[model samples]
Target: MKHREYGVVQRVDHHGRTAIVNWYRTYTSTDEPVPQLLYESEMSVYDLKDHPDFQYRPGTVVIRVANFTGEDANCTAGQ
Candidate 1:
C-alpha cells in the first residue's frame, strides 16, 4: 500500500489534527459497544487507490462485514 496521511480526530469536530491512523476497523455486530458521546466522529474518507469512483471511504481494507458465509471467510483467510 502507498503512504498517505490520515486523522485521529473525528471529522465533525471543531478542531482536528491529522494523526497517524493506527488502524481501521468495522463492526456490524450488535454486540459491539459505542458510547453515546462518540456518535459524531464516524465520518468517511475517500481513497482513489481502491475506489476509482471516489465513493465514501473509511480507509480500511474492505471486509465484507455482513452476510458472508463462514466458508467464504476461511477461503480468504488462507490467501
Candidate 2:
C-alpha cells in the first residue's frame, strides 16, 4: 500500500473507540492537489503525541504524514 505524506491535524474527535481526526492535507509535488480530510482511526491523542515521527505540539500543524505503519493506508480523512 502507498500513503501520501503531507497533512496536519486540525482537530481531534473522540466520540467512540475510534477517533475522527480532522486534518489538512498537503502535497509535495506541485502538480498534486491538496486534500483536507477527517480521518477516523483507533489511534488516540496520546498515541499521536507519543509518535516518534509526529511532533504533536500545541498549534503545531502537521506538514508531513509519516508513513511508518502500513495501517496509515487504511486511514482517510476528507469532506
Candidate 3:
C-alpha cells in the first residue's frame, strides 16, 4: 500500500473482515482526495465501486471519488 494513492479494490477478506487490501489500477490526484471520516469505513469494497466516494485503505488510489475534506492528513491516532 502506498501513501496518498488512487486505485481500485484488488481483493477483500472472505471472512468479512478488514484484512490486507491491495490496489492495482492506481492514480495520483493533484488535489487532495477528501473522504468523509464518518462514512469512510461505512462502505465495503463492493460498495466503493460506483460510489461517489471511492473509499479504501490508507492512501489508496481514489481518483475522482467525492469525499469529505479535513485539515488532518493523518486519520490515525497518536499522529
Candidate 4:
C-alpha cells in the first residue's frame, strides 16, 4: 500500500556516496481515534533524485515528503 511519508537526510558519507535518512510516518489507525507518527533512520546508496522516497533535489540538510510503500515505511534494520 502507498502512504504519505517524509524523509530527512541526517548524515552523508562522501567516500561511500551514501546518506543516512531519517524517515517519518503519520497515519491513522483503525484502532486509534487519532493520527500517530513514527520515525526511523536508514542508509541509502542512491542519489537524492534516485531514491525511492527522496526523488527531489536535496539541500545540505534535506526533508522530503512523498508517497512511500508500506514495506518501505515499516522496514527496520536487522529484520
Candidate 5:
C-alpha cells in the first residue's frame, strides 16, 4: 500500500486548500509502461514554494513527489 512519487508535470489545479497536480509516471520497477498517470494529493502551492525536494523557480513548474506506504497512508489518502 505504498505510494511512490515520480516525475512529469502536466497540469495544476488550485480550487481547494491543496493544489492538485497532474503528472505522469515516467519510471517504474514493475513491468508496466512508463509515462502513466500518477496522482498527487494534499499538496499546496505555498508548500511547493518552500519545499526542499524541489526549488520553485520563476515561471517554472514545481512538483513534489512523495512515497507513502500503508503506515504513511494517512498522509495522502482522502485527497
Candidate 6:
C-alpha cells in the first residue's frame, strides 16, 4: 500500500469518525489534484508538532491517507 500525507485538520465529524483536511495550496504537486477532505477511517492523523514542515500550525494535525492500491482505502481501518 502507498501512503499519501494530507494537510491540517479543518474540521472533524465526531459522529461519523471522519475529518475534513486541507492541503497547503502552495505546496501541492501538478501531477495530481489533492483532495481537500479525507476520512479518518482511511487515514491517520498526527499532531503538526511531529511534522517537519513549517507551514502548518502547531495545534493542528496532519493526515496520512491509507492507499490500498486497487482496493478501497477505508477497508483496512478497523479490520
Q: Across residues 49-69, which tens digit of lDDT does each residue of candidate 5 receive?
A: 432454555598644345444
Write candidate 2's Cα lDDT for 43-68 as tens digits: 46555543345566786665434333
RMSD of each: 11.6, 12.5, 11.9, 12.9, 14.3, 14.6
Write the residue-wise lDDT of candidate 3 on 1-79 in tens digits. 2343434444558677443334332334636553212112223545443324454556666343333347544344434
For candidate 6, lDDT tens digit of each residue in 1-79?
1134546666766666665655544325544544534333323344333445446655667565543444564565545
lDDT of each: 0.36, 0.47, 0.42, 0.56, 0.50, 0.49
Q: Which ten-residue region of model 5 has the weakest summed lDDT?
A: 1-10
Ranked by TM-score from best down, the candidates are: 4, 2, 6, 5, 3, 1
In model 1, which runs have C-alpha deviations exceeding 4 angstroms? 1-19, 34-79
Clashing pairs in 2: 37-77, 37-78, 38-77, 38-78
lDDT head-to-head 2 vs 3, winner: 2
Candidate 6 backbone clash number: 0
TM-score result, candidate 2 = 0.30
Given candidate 2, what's the lDDT at residue 67?
A: 38
- By lDDT, rank the candidates, best first: 4, 5, 6, 2, 3, 1
Assess the local accuracy of residue 6 in candidate 4 as a C-alpha lDDT between 0 and 100: 62
Candidate 3 wrongly placed segments (more than 4 Å): 1-5, 17-43, 51-79
Model 5 TM-score on a 0 to 1 scale: 0.29
Model 6: runs farther than 4 Å from truth?
1-6, 25-50, 54-79
RMSD in Å for model 1? 11.6
Best by TM-score: 4
Q: Considering summed lDDT, which 10 consecutive residues are worst modelled in model 2?
A: 1-10
